[model samples]
Target chain A: MIKTFTRNDLIRYIYQETTKEENTEIENALIFDEALCDELGDLQLTVNGLGRIERSPSKGSIDKILSYSKYYNMNAVN
Target chain B: MRKYSVSDSQLISLYKNGNEGAFADLVNRHKNKIFTTVYMIVKDQYLAEDLLQETYIKVVNTIKSGRYNEEGKFLPWVTRIAHNLAIDHFRKAKRYPTIVMEDGSNVFNTLEFSEDSIESQKIKEDTHALLRDLIKELPDSQREVLMMRHYMQMSFQEIAEATDVSINTALGRMRYALINLRKKMDKLNIAYDKNLYQK
Candidate 1:
C-alpha cells in the first residue's frame, strides 16, 4: 500500500523536521510530484521571508541576565 | 578552571555542584536566543527584558529546587519557560494580542524618513518594521504558532508540547500562517521577494 502524505507532512518535509523514513518517502514523492515540489519551494520561501528581518536583544539585556545570576548566587551562598 | 568546551549537560552539572562560573557560562551561551525569542512574542524591548530576567530567575529557582532534570536540552527547556511566561503575562493582564506600536500610532504606519539618504539602510529598517506590523495583524492563534516556529525555531513537536496542541494542529497553524501572510501581503500590495513565488 502506498502512503499518501498530508499537507502537514509536506510542511514537516519543508521544515526538514521529518524522520529518516518519512524523509525518504517525501523525497521519492517529490521526485515525481511537481506540485508537491512547488509547494515545498513556496513554503520554504515563505519561511525565508520571515527570516529577512532578524532582530537581537541589546547588550543591556544580556547584562540584566548576568546581574540576576550574580544576585541568585550571592543569595544562595549567604 | 572550568572546562569551557564541555556540553550543556556537563555545564549544568557543574552549576548544580555550585561551581563559581558555570551558571554564568550557561546564561551567556543562551541569553540572546532566549531574549530574542521573548522579544518576538512581547514585541517590546523593555518588557521582553523584564520577562527575560523573570525567566532566568525561574531557572535559578528550578535549579536550586532540584526539579530541573533537563540537561542537554537546556536551551529548549528554558525557551519553553520564557515562552510560557510571556503568555502568562498576557493572560494575567488580559491585554495581549495588543499591537505595541513604537510611536503609539495607528496601524498601516509607513516610513516618514527621507528616501534619498541611506536608501539601503532605510529600506531594510522599513521592511522589518512593516513585516513586524504585518505579524502583529495576524490572528492571535496563528501568530503564536508562527512566532514559535520561526522565532523560537522550535520543532513542530516542541511547539505542540509548548502550546498544548497536537503536532498536526501545530503544523496546520504554520501552514495557515504562511497562507494568510501571503494573502495579506498580496492585499496590501506589499512587495515581497517575488522570486520566491515565481518558481
Candidate 2:
C-alpha cells in the first residue's frame, strides 16, 4: 500500500521543504509503505548520524601545514 | 566573516602590496582547510602535507609574478590552485583519469560532526563510522558535496561557489546524496535506533 512517490517527494519531506499536502502524502505513506518507512527512517538516521561525525581536522595538522613557511618563505614567522 | 583571523580579502590586499605578514596570516588561516581538502583528494596524509606547500609556493609565485588574475579575492583563487596541484599529483602518478574530473567535480561522504555529550556520543560515533565507510564508496563528486556541507559547515551557496556550480546543482547533489545514502544503508541493513538522537 506504499503510494508510489518520486525522489522529489522524498527530498521535500526529509528537508521539511514540502507543502502541507506533500507532508500529508508522505506521512500517509508511512502507514502503508514499510520500505519507504525504512528508507525515510534511514535517511533521518543518516542525517542525524552525520551530525555526530568529527568534523575537525586532526590536532597539529594546522601547525604542520604552517611548517611549510620554514622552507620557502625565509621571512615567514611560524 | 568579519575579519575573525584576517579574512581572505584582507590578506590578499596585504600580500598584493608586498606585506610579508599577510602571507603568513593567510597560510595560518587556511592551512587546515587546504590540508583537509588535499588529504581528501590524495587520500594520503603525508602527500597532502607536501602538496600543501607546493600549492602555496605556486600561489606565491603566481602573485609575485603578477600573473594572478584575482586582484583582491584570494581564498577562492588559492583554493583553485590547491585543487589544481592535487590534480597534478594524481596526474604525475598516472592516476589522473581516475581522480580528476573535467568539471573539477569532487564529492565525498557526509562529515562526522564532533559533539561533546559522551553518553549519546558513543552511539552516534559508532553509527557515524558505519555511514562513513558506506559513503567512501560513493562517487567523488557526490562525496565532495556531502562532505563540504556536513563537515566543513559550508552553506549551499558557499558550496555552489566553491564547487563552481549553481545553487540548484548543489542542492540537487545534496538531495541525491541523501537518497543514495539511504538506499545504500538499507541494502546493508544498518540500523540506527531513533531514541539515540532524541536525547
Q: Tell me the DockQ of each model, to 2 decimals.
A: 0.43, 0.17
Candidate 1 stretches greater than 4 Å from native: A1-3, A76-78, B1-7, B17-25, B103-117, B161-165, B189-191, B194-199
Most accurate candidate by lDDT: 1
What's the C-alpha lDDT at position A24 in model 2?
Answer: 84
Q: For candidate 2, lDDT tens digit of each residue in B24-55?
A: 78776666556656655675555665677678
Q: Give TM-scores of the second chain, every candidate.
A: 0.71, 0.61
Number of colliding residue pairs in each model:
0, 9
- Cα RMSD over interface residues, candidate 2: 6.6
- Tens digits of lDDT, candidate 1, B4-122: 57888888889888874888888877675677677667887678778988898888878876888873378777888999999899999988645565643222122333433566444
Model 2 TM-score relative to the real fold: 0.53
Tens digits of per-residue lDDT, candidate 1, A1-78, equal: 346788889888877788999999888888888888887877777777776555455567667666766667566642
